[model samples]
Every structure is written in structure tokens, then in C-alpha cells.
Target: MSLFFKIPFDKKQIELAIESLELQTSAELRVYIERKKKNQHFSAFEQGLDYFNQLEMFKTEAKNGVLIYIAYKDQQCAIIGDQGIHQYVTEQFWQQQNRLMIDYFKQKKYNEGLINIIANISKELARYFPYQENDKNELDNEVIIK
Candidate 1:
């Protein structure tokens, strides 16, 4: 069983999110970032749609027994799998973003507003992958002589 999370945050935000995930107890975790070509002939909207289609393909490739999480500016979605990573992201992150938006609106800090939203999302992801105590003594002591 495997777990996957996809967040369509800004490039900087995504990098920060990945850095946080790297600190988890699970060292074999995999991460991928989707890139859009600038020379494409389509409009921004069309490019975004194409990117989503690629995401769907990635999800299918993830197969069964895998958990998936996705966070975009307009939407935040998650998929959970049994016997795999537990689901943790929820609506609260968005709620927090709303609150931050209000504050940013008052301060007129548009860039800060976006960064705040992504930071909150990253925090939520961090909470999902907490540190687990390692127990090496649970292994069997059986040995075979060849």
C-alpha cells in the first residue's frame, strides 16, 4: 500500500510543502511536481485544464491501496486507502485561509495572502505525517545455517 498527495500551490509553496514531508519518519516517500510548458498554443485556462487531465492520469497510475491528497487554490481534495497512509487533510485548512485572507485584505498584502494559504496547507500536511517511534526489537531472531 502507498500514499500520494498532490497540491497545486505556487512553485515556492510546493517546494516548502515537499521539504516538510521529507522530515517524516517514512524515508521512502516519493514526490513529483507537475510542470506546464510555456510555448503551448493554448490559453491559460486551457493549459490548466490540460494539467488537471495529467493529474487524473497520475492518480490512475497510483492504483489501489494508495492514499492521495490534492490542494489547489480553488479546491482541495483528498483520497484515502485502507491499510495505507491515514487521511488527515480537512476543511479547516481552507477555513484558516479565509481568515488569513480577511487579514491580508486589510493589510493589502496580496502576495502574503497567497503564501499564508499555502503555509497553512503545508502545516496540515505536516500534521498528517508525524514522527513514529522506531522499534527494532520486534524483529525475529531466527537464523539458518547454510
Candidate 2:
């Protein structure tokens, strides 16, 4: 039973959000969604890191890739940032963003919540890693569903 159809967001909306974010920073942001969990014991954060690695997020020249992993059926999600982003943002910042997102999810505002979250992250990324003339989007903006 894939929850993919039930998830309110369309890939284009997420892609547009990522595109807007990347226009302001060299940093990359990606979204990954899955219908269910592979292991009940694994936390969303742990599984996010696995996909982050598999996506080669850590290989960014600036180490500024960010991943938003969601298990729609489980109603759990995690946001992960590479070391470069960690240097600029505190744990509390991430927690705050998570809280905000959860609040929106509770209201079923998936599209609005994710778009806003990406915008918030873009501010920090722009501050620390402002876009360069030669900067290219090194990561795919296409949302992934698995």
C-alpha cells in the first residue's frame, strides 16, 4: 500500500522550492519520501542519513547538502544537514524547524509546510554560502519517492 498517492505534495512543487533555494546558495536541498519503513527499529533520522549517504550528499564540495526524508505512511520525517551546514546552525535551530513542520503536518498543510521550511533553510544557506556566478546545482532537485 503506497501512501505516495495519498501524500498531498506533487514533485513539481518541491522541485520549485529547491530551485528557489539553490538560486540563493551553493548549498543543496533534497527531499525523499517513502510509503513505509524498512525497519520498525530504525528511527527516521537514522534512515535519513542512510539515504543522504546513498545520494552522495556528503560529497558536496562545500559539504552543505541537506536532506528531508519522509515516511508518509508512518507520518515521520527527518531533516539532515551536512557538516558545513552544521557549523552554521545549532541543534536548536533544527529542532525549531522540525517543530514548525510537525505543527503544519498535524494540520495537513504538507505543501505549505515544506515550501516554508525550504525557504527558512535558504536564508541560512545564503548567508553562509551565497551563490557564485559559477555555481551550478550539483544535486538533483527532483523529489524522490521510494
Candidate 3:
């Protein structure tokens, strides 16, 4: 019963988050970004939604790492991570947002509207999987349905 976390996000953030995961040395990982079929000509938002839905197909797996989702709404973007990495990543994301805001403020170009939008997106990304403790054997026995 390894805990499962779900992140609903948008594409650019998802790409950066994946890059951050790749920097981790202790985890074995695989990342799937939903690619829009070139011939279909879907809108960017539609393509992101398709990828997010595709992630649901892997919900049953109990691997010892994370999965991510990227989604969009109107002009906002989001990133969601699996339970294994949610807390750490979400915290890091907020920290990053603060840094960005500070940088903008320091330049005396503090755009309140832009900052609020970023904050809103970050808030949406902060959702996490409720923690659950599981035995080693139980984790090992878990299966991911494709």
C-alpha cells in the first residue's frame, strides 16, 4: 500500500518539474509527457488535458517514485506530483514562487496581477495525497494496471 499522490498540472511546469526529478540521484524513474499527435492539430489546452487523462491509466501502480500531471485552465498553468514526492515538490514550488516575486519586487516592477495569478496557480498545485503507512511486503505486492 504505497501511498498514491495525484497532481493535475499544465505543460511548462510539468517539463521543469520533470527536469528537477531527473536531477535526483536516489530514485529510479520514468516520465511520460502527453504528446499531441502531430496530425490531429489539437489546441494546446486540449493536448494537455489528453495527457492528464492518459496518466489515469497508471493510477494502480505502486512504484517507489512519483508521477506528474500537467493541466491548464483559461490562462493559468499547474503541476501535480504523485504522493511520494508531493510534499517536497510542492514546498519547493512555493519557495520558487516567492523567489520570483521577490526578484520582481526588487526591480520595482511588482505586478500584483501577475503575482496573484502565479500564486493562484501555485495554490492549485499544492494539493497532496493524504499520507498512509504501508508495510514493505504490501508495497512490493502492489500492481499497476495499465
Measured by TM-score, the strongest candidate is 2
How are the candidates ranked when ordered by lDDT, highest leading? 2, 1, 3
38-85, model 3: which lDDT tens digit per residue?
224654334434554554522434332433221112122223334555
TM-score of 1: 0.34
Q: Which ten contiguous residues of candidate 1 have the minimum total lDDT?
A: 137-146
Across 81-121, the per-residue lDDT of candidate 1 in tens digits comes to 22223244444544455556546645655345544544454
Tell me the lDDT of model 3 at 86: 48
Poorly placed runs, candidate 3 (over 4 Å): 1-21, 25-50, 56-73, 91-146
TM-score-better candidate, 1 vs 2: 2
Highest lDDT: give the candidate number.
2
**Model 2: CA > 4 A from native:** 1-4
Worst 10 residues of 3 by lDDT: 137-146
What TM-score would every model get versus the actual structure? 0.34, 0.92, 0.27
| Per-model CA lDDT versus the true structure | 0.36, 0.87, 0.35
Better of 2 and 3 by lDDT: 2
The per-prediction CA RMSD against the true structure, in angstroms, equals 14.1, 2.0, 13.8
